[model samples]
Target: METIQVVFLTVLVFFVIVTIHEWGHYYFAKRAGILVREFAIGFGPKLFSIKRGETRFTLRLVPAGGFVRMAGEDPEIVDVSEGQTVALRVKDDKVTRIYLDRLDERSGVVRGEVTAIDLERDLFVSLDLDGEIERFRVHPQALMISKGKETQIAPIDRQFGSKSVGARAMAIFAGPMMNFILAFVLFAVCVQMAGVPKENPDKLFVGSITDKSPASGSDLKRGDTIFAVNGTPIGGNFKLMVDIINKSKDTAVKFDIIREGVKHSVNITPAFDKESQSYRVGISADPQTRPATFMETFTIAGKQMKVWTINIFEGFKKIITAQFKLSDIGGPVRTAQYTSQFAAEGIDKLTFWTAILSLYLGIFNLMPIPALDGSRLIFIGIEAVRGRPVNPNRESMVHFIGFALIMLLMVVVTFNDILLLVRGEQ
Candidate 1:
């Protein structure tokens, strides 16, 4: 049953995130007249499939990723100007390329030249003034073109760049916007399930201070009750620790502590342990666990949701900046190990952490990296600037590269997760 819970949570979160992402594209693409070939979850071999109109929907074996495959995702749009020949223009540059086939032939190749590029649209809009335009439907290779007697190869246009910039931008923005919508909806629902908490006075007392730690130098001693740090009141250990770590990078904190029924104050610089990605002022708590108010429970959960969202973004930033190594990343295996560890701590702890994890998943999916909703937004932003869509071929290539990089990162993280699980440390 424990294992079942982990699987269920993982699948539930993954499905929610991926569905929102793909649906974003599916919604916008249909509105834009783009033909979607497949809306799929997972990768590798297909586990199940359903055909609806022109779209083939499938659940694949892998649960880690998904895609929305559209025909216009390419730079070249299909044309049948002549019964035996098909022609296409470079979507952005307006250079036309032609392909020829015998009356009985099913496919043929065309050659042409193109110049002038649109980075935002990924289109090559104009060719050399005197260049020839050759269009093709077949013969993907061996296309040629020239200007002023100087010849150049003309590449086929994928329809992605051919669409209006607004259409292209909509397609790109759709995924991230969907993620945000999911997050907002989930957050609001969680809010309704849990109400906001009232501000409670600090009752958590420091039971120990590590020797030679920053807290020791700052006048913090055993049995000191911490009321606030750097002017931020501490309602509990989670809030106190989070506030400290957030400021650990550069700020020096002043602690308002009470000992022996007398209030005293101290200043300490929090130190960062790069490995844990957390901060410490060298003090330990006797785990002053408080009973949640009927209202505090909901508020506490909602606040945690907010904290987890911030943490997820910070983690992503650190990973990108190399402060967090890829080897430190965790996958489902690590997540399960953590779930198991917390489950043994009782339902409250497990439930709290689960809420945090859910929020993490919700926020992370909204990022704009390639193969991510966030990354799709970047493309959308570009289209908005260029007043036209990005070239389909270029867009596909960029995403392909991003996908490869993401896969590599995932492999590393998964290895790390498995290692942590084996050691029973996650």
Candidate 2:
């Protein structure tokens, strides 16, 4: 049951992040008038699908990452070779429907051998019928039925490549943008849920104690001010207090406190924390928190976001510069481990972890790596400089290679994560 809970929670956390991230792309793509073919969650076999508007939303078997499939985002498009037979439905001299494999025997459908076509520009199909060539106009919203699957033909105007560089960049960038939005919203929610923390200076007071920790069973109470530790005056210095306790090495330390104006002393032992390899009593200093005003909440969240972004970028820089080896990286296994660990603490702790993870995702996706949003932005940047788009095939090949390298790294990281788990290293 515990393992099942861990797995479920792990998938749920990833699912939430991926869903929000992909929805960002889908939202912007639709707004830009691009034909969104499918918005799918996960990979592999399809579990079910719900289509709305021009997009077919699908939930696949895997409970991992998802994608927003915009038309013309791919290097390959619909192509018809000469001397091939296909059925078409024409209305007002325009080809409204093209049947590739199904509905060929249906009435009012004209079947002919294809000689030439222009699906993107002129939207016309020329066919050789009984030794004479006849051309028919293709509708802007023509439906192409192939193997019983119907997909609306994407004209040049409705394709992703047709959009301006800014619009295309926004659609591509929206995935990471959404992740940042989610992080901010989660940060705001968590901040509001747990009162906003205000730093208190010139005072070392107890605010709370960790459950099952030494301080939780001690004589320390909330609002009690620490005056000294083991005969040394702390003088409202929290770090000094911590240093004294850590140096104690699981030995009982004397704590002098003033509780409600009454001076008292208590003996508390700092237990060893295997995770940090340090001694800890698990007591927190007074945060001096109060209910944040609506306007103040967002301000605090924004400031917190600044710190998260800095740390994320610094970590990426370290990894990119090879300060640490790639094999030292963690993967989904490590994430699952942390998820289970934090969830065991409480919902609030888990929520804080989720927000951090979301922020990391948002920032990581913006790195200039192939197969990432940042890489797409780089291509767009080049297009802006050159006054035209890059070759779609070349761009696709670069991304494909990048994706392969990423998968290779993932395998290595997963192996390392399991090894670390067994060896008990963080």
Candidate 3:
């Protein structure tokens, strides 16, 4: 069914972007000789898994995102809790176990002293004689217990910090770089399928050219043929419009026009329009076709990829600045509906939108916001500049804060998403 296709396509796009993003971390960590325990796609309970060597690859219940869990994340050096109040020595040298009131939820530094050990249950009951007592659960794997300030096991690999600055930078940038690569590939494919749009002089028809606008003062007429903008031959208005919008308000855009078979030059200072955030000489152009050659199609795709990257960054900036709000953002629910609508138009539209969405994901994750690949890179950059790696405890705390903020934002966005969906249904 159409709905099924829409859902399937949306999931495919989401997973591909997420998996590559996580893999970026996993690949570099391995290259740096860091131990990675798990690389999982999605969240919640594991739906399926396969172990390959030391890494366990899992497909989780939630398809929103994924993670590469690397080892050495716990830097506990000294395990000197052997001499305790009630130390029951191992009867058969068997595995020991212990349970805190609730071990799953607690994170951050948990300092405690083990006052008792029940050998039969293999549990180590501890008391917070010094600081806060954090619970720990005993598992099959050898427990890497941390007992307080004295504990110092390099959480991640020592070599991770020991690596050259350039190496660390490369490892950090790899995630975003991979996303850019994905956008480029997708853009190329989309371009090949459908010829790029262009603005042609012969097809120039004004969409809107406001009065008192700079265009009104020029020799250029409404239906005038636009041969080029600033001497660059424009096949279509999309690129030229994009350029105009990105330029400063005071910049004069020159258009070479042919009106009634007579060539003329028009220079107009574009005014900013908030709705589109594009500078306009108060003129719009008719859509012109630019059929791509086989080679040209591939090249154009790469071009579009670059264009999308810039747009994504600008959009995020606008949102952060309060120029846009949560309502302006769309979640997966809306994406699915939009995908279905586009799919109805035909496969070409669906594919094009898919490429666009993919590019969006790749670029957005690269943003230097907290709880993102970009933020991780920023931390890495700090380490590179400081000549010493950031303290793991501090860095983890920062990330936790970022994670919490991200979760709160997600809740708001999801609430907005549901509201929009219900309104549409009504």
Candidate 4:
């Protein structure tokens, strides 16, 4: 039952974050008059669906990710070859719908082997009816049914490319922008719960120990005040102690501290936080905090959000400059595990972790990688400078290859996550 709850919370967190991200895109696309075919949470087999106006909202089986499918966003979306069969829903003597699949299963529609078709441009389908060439006009808002899913046919006007470059860029960029907004909101909530922190370098103590931290398996405990490291007096500078630990270079360092009014010492070896590209003994400062002023909430939240974003960017830069390790990165499985662990501690920790995840999600999507919003924005920039858009087929193929490679990376990373979990490395 506990395991089930963890899985449920994990899914819920992902659902909320990803839905908001996709909603940003959907909202902007709709405003730009683009036909949004689907606003789907998750991927793979559909679990449930409902249509709202021109858009179909859906829930899918996988909890890993979601997408907003904007029509005409991909120029290669509708392709019907000559000599193909199609069932049409005609109205007012004109084609109102096109069924590209399961032709025998559709009733009250005309079945014809298409000889010539133009879903775009002419918006008509030509057929050999009784060996006579006949063509019928298609409706602007014609529905196309394929694999039992109905999507409105995108005329040139309703296509994403037809919009101004600004609209297209906004539609793509809004997803990440929403993520940053969420992180800021969540951080504000956290500040309200826990007062604003005031660093007390002079009064350092063990606040908590992570499960895999070197401090955990050592004599370190909460409330232990450290006064020296390897006989180097801290001298009211917490940074001095940190510098000493970092300079230790994974060597065992002796810490002199007073725990429960008794002077004692402990030896701890710092571990390489390869993911962050830093050396650490796995501890954080337990700073003294005071109640925040009402106005301080927003101010602190913005500052904290900015700090988290900058830190994440720097971490990625270090990871890129250093030797890349597969274990240095976590996939869906590992992230879910971390989410569960943090949530189990308390709502404050959960909120804190969620805010960090939101920032990471926001910043990571802006990396200019293919198939991401960043890459899409780059295309828009190129179009603005070149006075024309890139070839749709070429852009689509590049994104497709990037997507394939990403999926492959997900497989490898997920495998490593499971292996680490089994080996007690997680």
**What are the per-model C-alpha RMSD values against the true structure?**
14.7, 4.9, 13.0, 6.5
Q: What tens digits encode model 1's per-residue C-alpha lDDT throughout 1-426?
A: 366665565456567677777888888987876666689988879999988865789999877768888765544333222222232334333433433333233233222233333312332333233355432222222222222121122232424445666786678667756765555555544444433433553466775566567776767766678777777777565565556746665577777888888988887777876776867776766445434554654565556557767788788888788897555778765666666655543444455555556456546655666766566667767767876656756777887888889888777778888876688664
Q: What lDDT tens digits, residue by residue, belong to model 3 across residues 1-426?
A: 376776676676677777777788788877876656778998789999888865789999856677777554434333334333222112234223222323443343333457543321343444454565533433223323333211112222333555566766666666667666776776676666655556333344443455577676766665667767777776555566557535747788777777788888877777777788767677666555566777887678877877876787788889878898568887656666677666654566667776777678767766777767677778888877787778888877877798788767666766788898888741
Q: Write the per-residue lDDT of candidate 2 for residues 50-124, one digit (tens) a residue.
A: 888778999997554677888998943455678888889999889999887755466799888999988888899
Q: What are the models' TM-scores? A: 0.52, 0.80, 0.59, 0.75
Better of 1 and 4 by TM-score: 4
Query: Comparing candidate 1 with candidate 2, which one achieves the higher lDDT?
Result: 2
Give the true-structure RMSD of model 2.
Answer: 4.9
Quantify all predictions' global Cα lDDT against the true fold: 0.60, 0.84, 0.63, 0.84
lDDT of each residue in 26-122, candidate 4, tens digit only? 9999999999989999878999999988889999987767889987767545567899888888999889889999888889988888998887678
Which regions of candidate 4 are displaced past 4 Å? Answer: 1-5, 75-87, 92-94, 100-118, 121-137, 146-149, 197-291
For TM-score, the strongest prediction is 2
29: Cα error in model 3, Å: 2.3
Identify the superior model by lDDT, candidate 3 or candidate 4: 4
Model 4 lDDT at residue 290: 70
Against the correct fold, how does model 3 do in TM-score? 0.59
Candidate 2 global lDDT = 0.84
